[model samples]
Every structure is written in C-alpha cells, then in structure tokens.
Target: MATPPDWDRNATWGGSNGGAGGSRTPLRQAFSSLSKSSGKKTAQSLSASGSTTPAHPASRSQSPAPEQGDGKPTVASDAGLADDLDNKAKLSLSRQSSVSNKSGAGSAAGRDAGAATAPKGDGEEDTPLQRALKNPYHRPLPGHPGNLTTSQAEALLELTQLLLKDGALHDPEKEPPSYQETQLLRFLRARSFNVEAARTMYLKSEAWKKEFELDRLCEEFIFEEEEAVAACGWRMYFHKVDKLGRPIFIQDLSNLDTTKLLQTTTPERIIKKFAVTLELAVRHRYEACTLSSGRWVDDNMMVVNVEGLGLSTFWTMKDQLQQLLGVLDQNFPELSGRVQIIGAPFMFSAIWSLLKGWLPAATVEKVDIAGSGYLPLILKYVRKEDWPKHLGGECCCSGATATGSDGATPAKGKSDGCLHSDEGPWDKDLVVGASPRPS
Candidate 1:
C-alpha cells in the first residue's frame, strides 16, 4: 500500500492554551458549527438543560449490514449526524496533511475514503456480539453465568440514565454509543460499580476520544507501513484463542528493530495503528469470537515475547511502548482478558521493575511473567492445534501436519506457521464479504 501523507505531523489534543482553551481542534470546531447550524437541540444541549425527559427514542430500527461498495456501513437518515461528521472530518484533515508535506516526510498517515460505523445488520441466527452491533444497548447473552447480576443490571440502567441526563454518552457529531450496556459495564466494573466515578471516567474518555479524533482514526486511518513494520520484527497479530475462547494476540517483540521501525513509520502512525487495531478487535474480532464460542467474548488474551529486549533496546522503544500502554489503560479499561509474558530474559526483571511502576495496578495484576518452560502454561490456555508447532504446540500452518483430533488442520500457509496464519474461530464459518468489515 502507498504511504499516507499526514503521518509526521504532530497531533495536538484539546486547544492551544491546553484543556479546551485557545483554538479548538477542527472536529470540535465542526461540531460547534453543526450545533449552531441545526435548529434542534443536540443531545449535548439536552443533557445540560437538566430536563427530566429521556433522550433515547422510544424505539429504534436495526440497520442493515454493509452494502456492496467500499465495504463501509451505511447509516439511516436519522443518523445523519455521524455522516456529517465524516465529511467535516475529512475536510479538516488537510491541515495535518499540509504540515506533513511541508516537512517532506516520505511516509505519512492518511485516512481511508470514508469514516465507517459499526454494521447494524440483523440476522435471525446472529451471535450475541452480532446482535449487540445491531442494537447498541443489547442485553447480556442468555444462560451465561458471567451475565450481569440483577443489581448490576439495575446499575447499568441507572448508569445509562445518568449518561442520558448528562448527555455524556452520545456525541452526535462524533460517534454513537456501542454495545452501550457492555461499555457502561466496563466503566462500572473499572470503578468498582461507583456510578459517579464511572460517569467521570466515561466523560473523560469521551472528551479524549473527541480530542484524539478516535472515530475518524478507527474508520479511516490506514497503517501504510504494516508490512514494513512487520518485516522489521515488530509483530503483533491476532492468532487463535485461549481456553476461555478469547482471541490470542501474539506480540513477538524480541526481534524488533527500533531504528528500522522508526524509519518505516512515524511514532504517531504507530499510535494510530494501535488505536485502530483495538477498535477493529472490539468491533469485529470480538464479535466473531462471540459467535464462534456460542457465548459472549468481549476481550482478548495476549502473549508478549520479549527475550531479546536489552536495556539499550528498551530505552529506545520505551516512549512508544509507554504511550501504547497508556492508551490501553485509559481508553480501553477492563478489555484485556490476560497478558502472558513469555521468553523473559534475565535482564527482563530489571526492565519489569521500571515498567511496572508506570502501569495501573489493575493492568499489572492481569500480566503474568513466565520464565523457562513456559510452554506448558501457554498450552493450558491455548489448544495444541491452535498454537504453532514452532512455539511448542502441535499445529503447523503447512498442510502436511497432523494436529487435530479430527482430520482438521489449520489452513495451509508459509513454513513460519500459526504466527502468520490468522486462523481462529473468527474465520472458521463466516461469510461477510470479499471486502473486510468496517470497524
């Protein structure tokens, strides 16, 4: 893929004077203009009015899946606000583009043609996650013990009420709420079900999303250096699943060439890629996993291999990694299933001591650092047929391998095996289309 033209430009959050001061971001300005142009009060306005009236419509229609062209989700007329945002966002992106052009950067970040929203198609046999896409505030999947408790359900209702009254959930000109019940639960769980604290966190997250232009980033941002970055040994891809059926994200950072990676893609581009990837996982991968598992699968399991990370390499990549981790902690709370760190070298201890201090206590608790003979622990979560033979599991992407109990084998691929083969429940039995699904 050709490189985008806005990768090197600096991304500013809020306004110049800082914290919603000075000049507003182009999207924020667009939203302000939109609110003025439209005579009706926006959700934001309604919330501030402090009216007891409810904001949501009495009933909502489920939208259809992606139509033929461009693989983007189509919204109804009532959802025109999001469509307008997409147009304005595209126009405002040129300021960043011009900055990159002036700097003469060879590879820059550029958005895809349109800002796509989640598909809202209704299929009678759809999985819980798919149904959730169709209806933003979907109820929990039936018969799952992990389903919300009676009190938690009531709390969810209360939380949504608070968000509606505060107008903190929906930013009409930016993006709509997604899996709203599950999303609210995420914040509630993160804040230990304190409605006020969760509300605060949710509001801050929404503000940050606007400042970061998250909707546009998720819909249109393209990682032009994906192949080159992978070639440089910065590999992180969704592979198979763990015991609980969450997608397994294999991040092999042992061979990362920091200098080459920087040369290939800007740090800004890398951050955008990370955000986009998470958005995709939330929108598509998790949904597919939920379908395949016959239960709701909301998060993912990650395995990080850091054998070759020395002090020098750590210093070189620390800032980027820190930013990525911060993004995970602040924006995507309660979404990680587990993080297993394998192939830890002796020096990894010293590195962990420094790094753990910077991470949230909750996030730190989710991570498990394993030493030699860690394969057994990994296998306990990942099936033998799903993991790569090279990684000490049974499956080999090559067709000749006999791995599964049945005559099943992973779809054939290169000799490197499961690391590159994105074979999982997500791909087993689905027919979305030739084009990739919208985030």
Candidate 2:
C-alpha cells in the first residue's frame, strides 16, 4: 500500500526501457510460440532481459516444428508459385477485393483453401495485444490512456440499463448492487467494450460470487498448507508492492520434486489452494492497496522462476498450470501487470510450443521469458535488495531451494525474519537493506 516507487512510471510494454509509450503487441505476436520466424526462434527472445546468448550453440531446435505432410517438408516450386500468383492476379478486381474481405477470408466458396487461411487478424484494427489489454488493470494499460475511456464507460452504463430492464438487477440501490467506476470498467473492458458480452460476463461473475460465497471464503479460507507447499518448492507467496503498488507474487516451479508434490497433494487440491489465494489477493489485497495508496491497484506482478525444469517436471505440472492460467485468463482477465519467466530452461520451449495455442494470445504476449540471466530484468521491477539471494540478491529467503545441495526441499519451520518481504520498506523504496518477498 505504500506509494508506488518512482521507477513504476518507467514500466513499459514496448521495447524502450522505462518511460516507453508504445505497446509491444506487434513484437510479442511475432514471437508467439506459433510464430516460426527465425528471429523469434533464436535466443533473441531473451534479449529483452539484457542477456547475451552463449557463444557456443547451446539450443538444439529453436521450437517444435509442426508435423510435416507425408514425412517430408512440402516443397513449393517457384514455377508453380508464379503460376498461382498470375492466376490470382488475372481474376476480376472486384472478385479479388471480395476475396480480401475479412468476412469472406475463411469462406472456401470462392478462394483457394490455402488463401482462405490467411492471417485471422488482418481486418481487425485491434491487435491481439490490444484485445488482451482492453480491460487492463496495469499501469494505465501500457500505452492506452485513462482506464476505461469515456466511451467505454457509456457502453458499460448501457449494459447496466439492459440488465435492469431484464430484472437481473431488481433494486437500483440494493439489488444487483453498485460497483466502483473502475470495477464496472473492468467488466466492460474484459469484454472488449461490447455491451452484451460485458452484460453476460458480469452476470456470470456475480452469480459465481454468490454461489461460492466468496465473502465468507475471504473471511475464513485458511491456507493451512501454504508453508508446507513452500517447503516443497512450489512456493506461492506475495511479498510487497512493486514500483506501481501492485502486489508481487512469486511462484517457484523450477525446482519441484514431482514425486514429493504428488505424494503431498493431488492436482485438484493444489489448484483449489491456488484459486483461493488468487481470489483473496484480487478481492482483498487489491482493495487494501488502493485504499492505502489512494491509487487503483487491481492487477498483480508475476515472477515465475522456471529454473531447473525438465521434461519430468513439465509432464507432472502441465495440467495444474493449464488449469491455473486458464482460470486466471478467462475468469480474471486483465489482472496481470508484468509477467516475467526467469531461469527458463531450453526444455521449456517444447512445452510452450505445444501450449501456446491453448493460451489466450494477449496473455502470451505479456510473458517475458529469459535464461538464467534474468536478474537484471527482475531488478527493473523490484530493487536488488529485495531479490532472493539464491537468484543473486542480498535477501536470503528461508525456503529457497538449496543452491549447492540437491533439489530436496529444506525442512519446515518458521522462516528467518528476512524471508518475509512485508517487512521490507513501505514508507519509501528499500534501496539499501534487502527484504525478502514473503515466504
């Protein structure tokens, strides 16, 4: 809840470090796991972290290539390509224009099967990036102006009236309840300023809130096993505010012992705990931050440490991750500030290549993947003093995986004071003595 550090204003989605005004939607899309451009395939994706690629070629394949037709890469003869182009060009101009129309892009009636598969985003003015940010809860939505532009507000009000007429909201003052301007905007933004979509989404979320008794959950849901989970290398801890007053959530998935995790808990139980934590964070921590700092704080900054991950870990954790991220994406849209994946192993590319299609494009764009050399980038959002010592900082979180020792989790016990990041400076930036993000 402390005032956001001045460095917060420097958070930029575009390429420029600190103070950039553009959104890197184009670049992010270009690097999407589905995108096979050589530039994206290379280690260049890690360049944003300010790390240099090793001189010796360390990567095998940049990404997983698609299954080929008949075990051979399809060969397109130059002559055949030229003929196809000529035939297309010879068509009537009107015919070509009609083919170009977005509505007809996927229609096989008049276009070649290959042609019909043209990029899906061509006619849409909003990029995948823009759509993802429509309901932004982060720093003024990267480049877009004030949260929920005036026009968006009007659209949301229209939705309210529709719901009112439908009797979905019976009492203007009591029933269906009133929400903050920003909260109302969040629903509208999540649905891309579309009134009906927002209406439906808002109604469903309201129903979910009531059905789950979220109020009571927030009051009573005790994460009794949090410390136990932390000891298993599956830490989900919220330490302190970022430069922007958004809470920092650290989840270490890199060093997990899958066998131990399975024995300790089932996938469903683990997911339930995560959902409860996220709900509490969104509903409580966010409000507390906004109240204390007198600034809107709904989104959170995520630091995913994927160090020491291997195929075994991926197979074990895939379902859990898919479920967690899926809920966060569709149900809790626009709640991500800056998502950084540090210490990513080469093996991660395989999983991502397969998983990218399943994730929302906007969410995919927000992830910044880096090799072990992500410390500098992490410091951009959190001061070095507050960083975990295992990752090259002064603070030594009590439960961090043993560096020199094997990946076995340390014993369960109360952490040393430094492991709790809440103790970190709040009145001002902790520029000197380091503080641990919570254990």
Candidate 3:
C-alpha cells in the first residue's frame, strides 16, 4: 500500500481540538469536535484528510440543543468520528463503560424488524455485489497509520485471540472459514475494541446479512426506477476522489421533487437502492480504491447539496430519510470519512433539527454543515478537478465542454452526465490484478 499521508502529530482528539485529554473517554472525544452552535455560516474545519490541519471552531460551553428529545443521536459512540485525529485511540472499549448498543446504535431493533419483515429469497437472479459478498475474498483496509496506534495494535492482538478462542471468527456454514485483519479491525474500531462486543456485533451482522439475503439483493436487485429517480432530481452516485484518495459520493437534493419521487418509486425500493449502492462500495469501490491509491481505502467521502430543500419537502420525506439512516447505522458502521452537507438553505436548521435525531451520534459528529460560501470549504477536501462543474469544479461530466487547465478531461460516456457516469479511479484498469497506480 502507498504510504499514508502525513497529519499533524500533535493534533489529537483532546489537545488541539477540545476537551480534557486524560479525562476524556472515547465517547467524549468522539463528540469533542462538535460545536454546540448551529446556523452559523462559517465553515467547520472537520476534515480528517491527512494533507491538512486547519483550525476548527471551538466547542461551546453550553451544550447545543438536542436535535431530538435527548441530545444523543442514535448510533454507537465508538470513536468513529471524522475530526478526531486519533479516532482509534479515543475508542474507550473498556468492558465497564456505559456505552450501549455496541452491536450498533439501533441495530437490535433494526435486526428484529428485518428478520420479521424481510422477504425470503425466491431464487431470483443474483447481482454482482451479491455474488461478490458470497465469494470468499480478502483485501487490505484503509492503508493508513490511523488504524493502529501502539495500544490499538495490542488491543487488536487481544481481540483476535478472544474471537479465535470463542470460535466466532470462522463460520463455514454461514460465512468464509477465515477472516482478514482489516475486516476484524473495522468491527473492533466500531465497538471501541471491546472484544466481546466486537465479537457479538460481528456475529450479529453476519446473521443479519444471511437473514436479509443481502448478498442476493446486491447481486440481483436493480432499481427499475433509477432513471426516473434521477429525472426527478434525486441524485446519488459516486463521482471522484478526495485529496486523500477517498471516493466521493455526491447526493444532490437541490433539484429533488419529492412528490414526483414518491409517485415514481416506493420507499422500499429507495431503501434497496441505497443498500445495493453501499454493498457495491464495500465490494467494488473500496477494494478498487485500495488497489489504485496504494493505501487502504475503506471509507468514502459524502457531498450532499440541499440548496433547494425546504421544510415541507423535508417533512414529507422524513420517514424515508429516517429509515435510510437506521439502515446505515445498523448495517454499515464507520464507513464514512466525512459527510459534508453543503448549499444549506434558510430552513436547513429546521431540517437539521429533524435530521440529527435519526443520525447516530458518531455519524452526526462526522457531518459538517455549510449554509453558504461552501465552494471553497468543500474544495479543501475535494480538489477542483475531481468535483463537478455544478459544484464549482472544473470537471464537466455533462459533455458541455471542459473549462479548467488542470488537465481533468471530461470522463467518457458523457451522454449519461456526471451523476450517472459513476466516474472514479476504480474505473481505471489498475484495480483488478494490475499494478497500483502511481501515487
């Protein structure tokens, strides 16, 4: 793997960011970068990119008003937060800690509902993502030092031994007979390295995958309403990479016509679309990126544009949105590098109030909201060449015409436009058994 990028050695979760270093536990440090204040126009420096260390806004003395009844969001409190420099270190995985739902923030309920409600497979055609899931494969995780501190390395050793002894690491009937370190570490980090908790979560997630036949969904299911959904201005697709080589997932609600979307597709299909995309990311995008970037690229960066989203529209889709969040929190833990929400409109605060409640506390921390002047802020993490022209970048995947001198040519198959192109390094010939691209 390529050498991990350089980050400031001194900027830890507590020191340069906020909170008392020693007194702060993993949970506290996870929330350390979150400012109590909201509705501010200024950009929050929440980038976990290895290339920069810009100043972040100070945390307010008074805790910000909770988006829900209690201030806590619904996800697990493991140190999977984006801004914490040493996120792995902040994982206070001690067995005695009060952090609940180590399997996931709201996974128990989700799992139960899934088991009861999930449709049994009828031997439909399988999808590529599903096939990939069933086949045994191992790939390096995010090739970065952030995954392992000296203590984390030791903790990893301990966790591995415990899982091994428990006979939880291998399951020939349900899963492959072996596992990868990267895979194990992903769960351990999510549960703050609590051996028993990580083991339980791992087992439960595997069961959930089997019960839901997630692999089959990924392999066979295709959104018949994909074109219609895009025509309705609900954009969700992989575009490019950030400065640190993480793939960028662009979700534009600026032109979303919620009514048309509802008329065209059902809530169940929307959720399925999202799940397929996520599984693809894990099976294809993440692996391709890891191979191309010469670094383990496990997570992706999100860019959400909510310029025209209004309170009414938000309220109309609130249920669907919460269901999506629940799916993410329950199934895919710690898979985001950062979730940058840009082009926030006047009613965004109200929207945020409703939205934060559905998000996990760890995920809420990874989110960085910007009302305006977001182009420059977003550029800090995503370079102009990789970004789309609509987002104020040089690349014009719409085939209009390339304008920048950065040599970022319009991606092929421009007829589909940028959102539909699904363009990124993963498309290059370097992913599958080829040599790593030059970093």
Best by the lDDT measure: 1
Worst 10 residues of 1 by lDDT: 110-119
After TM-score superposition, the amount by which residue 295's alpha carbon in candidate 2 deviates from its true location, in angstroms, is 3.6
Model 3 lDDT at residue 47: 11
lDDT of every predicted structure (CA atoms): 0.52, 0.46, 0.51
Model 1 score (lDDT): 0.52
Against the true structure, candidate 1 reaches a TM-score of 0.59
In candidate 3, the residue pairs with backbone N, CA or C atoms under 3 Å apart (3 or more residues apart, or in different chains) clash, namely: 2-294, 75-360, 126-219, 126-220, 127-219, 127-220, 130-219, 141-296, 142-296, 143-296
Better of 1 and 2 by TM-score: 1
Error of 1 at 25 (Å): 41
Q: Candidate 2 — worst ten consecutive residues by lDDT sum? A: 47-56
State TM-scores per candidate.
0.59, 0.56, 0.59
Candidate 1 lDDT for residue 235: 70
- C-alpha RMSD of each candidate structure in angstroms: 18.2, 19.2, 19.3
Better of 2 and 3 by TM-score: 3
- The alpha-carbon lDDT assigned to residue 219 of candidate 1 equals 52
Candidate 3 — which residues are off by over 4 angstroms? 1-146, 161-179, 398-416, 427-439
Assess the local accuracy of residue 433 in candidate 3 as a C-alpha lDDT between 0 and 100. Answer: 17
Question: In candidate 2, residue 66 scores what lDDT?
Answer: 25
Report the number of clashing residue pairs per model. 2, 1, 10
lDDT for each residue of candidate 1 in 1-439, tens digit (9 for 90 to 100)? 1112332212222221112444323322222222233223322222222111122231144221223232111221212322332344444345334423443422221111000111111221211222222222221221111333344445566778998888666443333223345567677766656678888888887778778887667656666666677677677676776655578888878667888888998878777777767756654566445434423467778888886777788889889888878776777786775788988888889899989987866567678898757887787667677776656677765333444434343333322545445666443212122112223
